[model samples]
Target: MSISAPDVTPDVTPNAPWWRSAVLYQIYPRSFQDSDGDGIGDLNGIAARLDYLVDLGVDAIWISPIFPSPMADFGYDVEDYCGIDPRFGTLADFDALLAAAHARGLKILLDFVPNHSSDQHPWFRESRASRTNPKRDWYLWRDAAPDGGVPNNWISDFGGPAWEWDEATGQYYYHAFLKEQPDLNWRNPDVRAAMLDVLRFWFARGVDGFRIDVLWHMVKHADFPDNPLNPAWHVSMGEMHRVLQRHSTDQPEVHAIAGDMRRIADDYSTPGEERVLIGEIYLPLERLMHYYGQDESGVHLPFNFQLIDARWDARTLAQMIADYEAALPPGGWPNWVLGNHDRPRSATKRGAEQARVAAMLLLTLRGTPTLYYGDELGLEDAVIPPDRVQDPRELREPGLGLGRDPVRAPMPWDAGAHAGFSTAEPWLPLGADWRTRNVAAERDDPASMLSLHRALLALRRRHPALGVGQFRLIEAEGDVLAYERVCGDDRIVVALNLGATPHPVILPPGAWRLLLSTTPDPFTDTLAPNQGVILQPER
Candidate 1:
């Protein structure tokens, strides 16, 4: 029989920040929902879906970059940091969206691309105009090598050399990602001040927070030394993996920069207006802890992506979670992510059954969980035809399956024309099975993946133990992984069978009642294959 979420409300502390136990939903603006029939999602489109997000039970939404850009790297390359892209909408439209979201008690987070700006940005245009220009030092520029080749051996994240030659200026500029995107010189005091002002601009406009793009890549070694070659690098890896990036990323000075951003966020924090700072960092857990800053003044939440790349097995995931929990600095809150615009979706990486188990693990874990859009409907990677591929990464490196276009497909609202995303043709293709997998189709199905997510999120909100309680690993062996979350008198035991075989549930001596289960079967001593459940002590 199908199980439903119990009617309960969790006790929340009055002064505590909402992000500590909140569920953040990531929205790719171009793909979420299109309002103007332009085949691209705009601010109005997102505003229209605010109720949908509210119904889904997410506390906040983290939208990818929506700033004015040339679309060379989608929205990551910002041309105007302070203005919204025309494709999305005007500033008034954004204000309306923010106000609407806040009205529903939902927070808003915009992607902050501080590491690099579009080549068309006025700052970069002036900096590239002449070497002696006042803004020349605003971006990284260097003279060519003796042989007139590239400046250094640095490689772009897309592929090939990271440096691009400027024929007019006769110098090279650095870009960590695309040649059309120039890296900003954060070492310059004026550049830092300007980027910090960008944060203040949003906070002043009532934006809740920011999800910083490439936070660790902002600071580079002062000497600009060549990165060492990676011995473990293989041909199968991306070209950027050839070098260890020892001097190019994760520099010592980055912490100071993070601290500066944190101070700005704090400046705007009042009793009810608590601004959060989330850094998108992909580093080892040990090094990732430093982003929290000294005295806990750094980024509020450094996005944890270990689950995205971790092995989808019982023991491996359990150990990884423990290690991450142990590595957080004092007073540092934790967050988790299953997928984003850059990586494959959880359902695509693991099968549909395992994805349900993953959803249980994500919401029940002792941290804020960020859910990628479309994963709730159990959407898989869209099949992009060769002619229809839009991702520059895949276009640059074909056949490697590195293209993110598949995961960035349009959100299927219904089975109508273009899956009800837009009247016009979408910029990207929709999934093949949108007819049955769309949100409209699964909204009422009690056993659908969408329903499972709603139930899990409802359960998380109803229990203090699952929200901000202590986490203790009860068992992690073979196909089963069990953990207990205890908050004073409220205690929850989360058990999962990650493998495709039944595993006996091993709980403490106390009698337990099954609160929810991924499978339709009733509570039993054994957990069915690819099943997960939440239990509480029988008082």
Candidate 2:
């Protein structure tokens, strides 16, 4: 049965799309929960945890790639887009998981990798079989320079030349990420049709939507020119940042791809069962809006990652939020993300105290919000032993701390061995404090981070103003950042003290009731240090 949006958010129409007011939870499958004692998570593991997510109040779950892959860039290198990897599970297992999720009012979003595929993929194999092969145009390939050097100065995100020599074909192929993950030539009509059909396959399987990986990198310059050097580049930055990527990414042609994707997704939509398309883009807010497409026909949400990289302070965040709101095209819905598989955990970046504050902000802000798995427990970056580091980026760029292993630690379920995540040693390490910070410890504690997240989510469900309403920035100065969410006659205010010192909050003229707070302090004219509160004007 379709989830009744009206049953959750008051005054919401049954016809209204669920995604606009939904809170999405992201599950890094390799780390969420492991079954079969294999020390790696799988589809069944996620199905077993459905009740937990439903209880936590997330409307949907956006899982990272589970398609068959070489695991070179970990699942980003798709070997078979239609089949499920045995490491994760089979197609039947995925079907069962989808049914279980929908039965409990949850939607599932798959990760789509349209820009590239593993070199092992049959398509790539056939394309590289011979230069005269019918599929040679399926991927980006060019002849070596007059000096037999690389075709261009393009650099891979994983470092070194983006072009790799294919001895079999006597040509250089481009890979924006890893050599094993060759870029697909989107310019090829056949490539577009095949990828679009991939979406059709899953949509037919009841997949709710997709979070397209590297949406901006789907198309590159036609001439394959050298990317300009970044004047601000420094040794501290990743080697990819050495170039400005002016001609390599966010190309104008990519917007059309996004539109094509949106049209395919729309074909799968119903009144309340609308499918969503979320693009994983990392660009300036102005340029990012283009993914929304002309007249909002593009991706439903372009993924606002501003919060992930923003300075966790009043002034900086305030300006960013304002700028983002201003930059959004008319009728475009905004979203917020603080942490994900690729970035550091919020607790690791802002400390435990401020992580709670960040949570309050994420939940109370306007538009859709995606919560990373384990964030509700305030999970920090787990300490990875040198031998346990499995991220390819970390292996390639040793000692740079660019590895994502730390943030991708296994979810701490309880105090048992491996923090109850698996029966055997997990693929990655659990946080050292897992014993006390696990879900079993925090589930019943009102003051625990998990409980706080639960309360905020429950609050959003009860108040449309908090979930999908107009936002107005009230004050952003010193240590306090305040905003208001309004819908019809319902009005609520959120205030955060981003510093270690107590900050006085001058509520807008009206009697107000404290709905929730990060700190245990009773409602007063002042907020405790590192505290955040949701308030409503008393009638």
Candidate 3:
């Protein structure tokens, strides 16, 4: 049964698309909450916490994959596209969560893994039945090279070659990530038609949008070719960086595929409804902009992760901001993300103080910002001992330190035996400071990270200048970066000192009042070391 449209009009930009300035919060389910004491999170657990999410002030929630899987690469290796994983919940549970979320005026976006599927999927099972099976062309399968070696020089993102030999068949199948995950043959029209129906299944179920994972990897060079060796490749870096992946990713054909996917999503729209499709692409800004498609026919938003890959200092960051803004297509809307399940927590990358400053920069920027779970509480990466590590990346490459276990730890809700996340031991251990760092401890503390986030969110809610205004760079030297956001008469100036020592902000002569600051009460012009502040009416 379909869910009713949200009764309350969402708190969104008056005349603009809802996603333009929406604050999206990502929930990694297993670590979010576990209601059954089974040491894993489920949909019911998420539904239980809907009120908390509302209070946190997010406009939408983007949950990671909850589809049925064999737990090989966690939920990324999906076995069923239309069913919920037994560990996560059943069909009814998801329907309940969707209705409850919409009732709270929060839009929900599901993670769509398009690049590959678990070897156990019904499609893959049927495709591998025989070389001449009716569905044999559903997946990418090629005969062994002339010398009987793996098909090509393609390397898996998880290390080793990208193909796995099948004993029952006289061929090797391609896999971009895990051998258990075989890439789909997207070039096949039948395959494309089948995948389009998958989008329809969820869209008809009332999902507000989809966050397509590995969007660039969906289409690859038709004739398999060796990826060029990276000039900057070093022995110390992850194996994925060893090749440039020129032929393996970001192919020209992908734009058309994206356009088709966007059209399917648009089909579900009603008179006043807009169903968004956000692609999780990590290509360069120049290549990234093309996903928008000609005539606004592609993805609604291709996630911009430049911030995740850039240096933490002001000079490098400022230039990246300018370049990103300049590179957007005429009608392309922008988005930003400070951290996600794939990367280290911002607090761990740049110390706690700077993390607070980053929060300010992310929330006050001109575009939409996606906040990963637990970052709002200033949670640092949990230390995962080698014996307790759960990430496949870390297990596959131990010495390279590619483990994502640290960042995927369970959320700490309060001071409890399991940090109030689960009654049983969590799948991944909780961070060490949960007793003091949990939500309960920080909600009332004026100087805590949680309080700071609430203040910033409150300010953004009240002032369109900070959330959806026009951004203009202000000339500032040294480690300080300054910019102005203006929405008619409601203009605000923001300055940040990325260094460890206090920096004098060179502002035009005027009475600039501090609207919000990382510092304690009684703000001033001299931004304390690693601090960010919001001011009004630039002279």
Candidate 4:
């Protein structure tokens, strides 16, 4: 009897599609690193950390904003769409960062502020020059109220009225964030073309894609009708949330604009690869999927924020998982995010000690996982002094505690002065106990949350089932969450204990083998508190 071995030809390099099995790590640039000793992070700092990112096993990086801005709302307020801020280094620094990133097999995606521009932007300046200016229609401007007051009762996200009175033009300009960040009139053809040109400029510079900021708010009602008031007086940060925002944002026409933006992205695509366009949408699931469009012609991935909204229950987790999987377009890829600069870090939200469990869930989920800066180190929210509050919303609504500055503090890189983030007085104060939570300390400890993250990401890279496999919810009771990831000949069951107490989970009896776990000793036949287990199904 003769035995034959299966023939294995040379593995061809797979074409890298934008959304297929990609892990995107979002870098809040200003808080990521500082190289110029200016007490603020810049592109140079990001370039220096390419190896750190490459070692972490993420496929790509999505940097928040480094574009030229007045820093009114950080970099979300774009002053020059095609230019890099001097504070963040010159355009050459960005080009070098892109080059170095690509060389290290990392793709770079930048934040695109399409919904609005800094009031100081030349276009906005031109628009506000006069009612008859050629660019007067670039931004959303309307006449004063009948009572000679400001426009409508629409509230800005940063607090105060959405419309700002422009004395020179005798009209009010609309801004959904800050008065200085005027909303662009997407209704205007010229404005659309100009925004597209901004995309082209970066694409030509070798940018992989864009994470559109406030994407759903690009289009507003042509009539500029006052938004209906919300009957529910929900309070999160302490401010009275009385105003209803029905008509001001998330308009239906936003989809059409998204489709157009998709077309613009398509124009810049390579042979068979898709250009990435991730929309920063905060709407409910039903409305969120619309950004992808029916035929997958809109945004590549409208961020699924289920983890952000989930309350850490087996039932909630199972249902949200099913709903999100069902909501995707046939070939549409899914993405998961637990934290961002705008929201509280998952560590703080899920209890500082439970951060490991949150990381396990985020990494094992059936989609690209986005890890916010400082999250891997289990960094908690900083305590922002009332006098040092920078967020306009927090200033306006003093009692709400609604500001985002706490979560946007400098990353703890070392135990040195300023945590090695900056030599000068840091822009934001470092978190308390930085000595223990700093990256330097965590890098040396194999049991640290940072090390666990690195191990999980490494495991994810080796297992295709975790990256692009179909997710099946497995049966589990109480706070135990179980799921199976299957891809072709690979299959693995991932069980997670989201509670503080150890939970026993009976495997679907087979040749069960532990693949990975957040617990220090997962293979010891013990499930520790907030432990996670990835078991290979027995053949």
Candidate 4 has its poorest 10 consecutive residues by lDDT at 1-10
TM-scores of all predicted structures? 0.97, 0.97, 0.96, 0.94
Pitting candidate 2 against candidate 4, the one with the higher lDDT is 2
Model 4, TM vs. native: 0.94
Alpha-carbon runs more than 4 Å astray in model 2 = 1-14
Compare candidates 2 and 4 on TM-score and give the better one: 2
Candidate 1 lDDT, 58-108, residue by residue in tens: 999999999999999999999999999999999999999999999999999
lDDT of each: 0.90, 0.90, 0.87, 0.82
Please write out the lDDT profile of model 3 over residues 1-539, one tens digit for every residue: 11111111122354567777679999999999999999999999999999988898888999999999998999999999999999998999999999999999999999999889999999999999999998898899999999999888888899888889998988999999989999998998998988888999999999989999999999889999989999999867888888988888888888898999988887887644578899999888888889888888889999999887679878777788777777776777778999999999999988899899999999988788999999999999999988898888888888786788899899999997898899999998899889999999998998989998988888888888877777777777788888877776677888998999888887756788888888773556687888799997535
Better of 1 and 4 by lDDT: 1
CA-only RMSD, every prediction: 3.9, 4.4, 5.7, 5.4
Backbone clashes in each candidate structure, one number apiece?
0, 0, 0, 4
Output the lDDT of residue 150, model 3.
88
Tens-place lDDT digits, model 4, residues 462-530: 877887776777767777887877777777788888888877775666678887777765553446778
- Candidate 1 local distance difference test against the native: 0.90
Candidate 2 local lDDT, 153-202, one digit each (tens): 88888878899999987999999989999999999999999999999999
